[model samples]
Target: MTTGQALVAVRDGTFLPGPCFMPCVDALLYRFRLVPRSILVMGPVGAPLLPP
Candidate 1:
């Protein structure tokens, strides 16, 4: 994939149970048209990952 534009992963809100909080993520899937130059998590911005 080629670099087209900057993209950020976002979610509307955290998960919740029937009557309580239950934060969770079904999965961490990165679906993009172009290859991202960098992917950031809890660490520094613009962190690099393995080349495709």
Candidate 2:
């Protein structure tokens, strides 16, 4: 998802945005140790991401 989309997601959720580290850790867990085993790095929170 795009950064905008992620922002929306985080906003929609009960929690407010904090540090990027938390999401990075979550992504890592799903990347190598969880079901589906997939992760997408969306240019860090509050940063710019060029459309591909």
Off by over 4 Å in 1: 1-29, 34-37, 41-52
Candidate 1 lDDT over 1-52, as tens digits, reads: 2232222112113222311331122112224323232432322332234232
lDDT assessment of candidate 1: 0.26
Best by TM-score: 2
lDDT of 2 at 31: 70
- TM-score against truth, every candidate: 0.12, 0.28
34, model 1: CA deviation in Å?
Answer: 6.4
lDDT of 2 by residue, 1-52 (tens): 5999989887657344434556676677777766443334443543444332
Residue 1 local lDDT, model 2: 58
Clashing pairs in 1: none
After superposition on all CA atoms, how large is the RMSD of candidate 1? 15.6
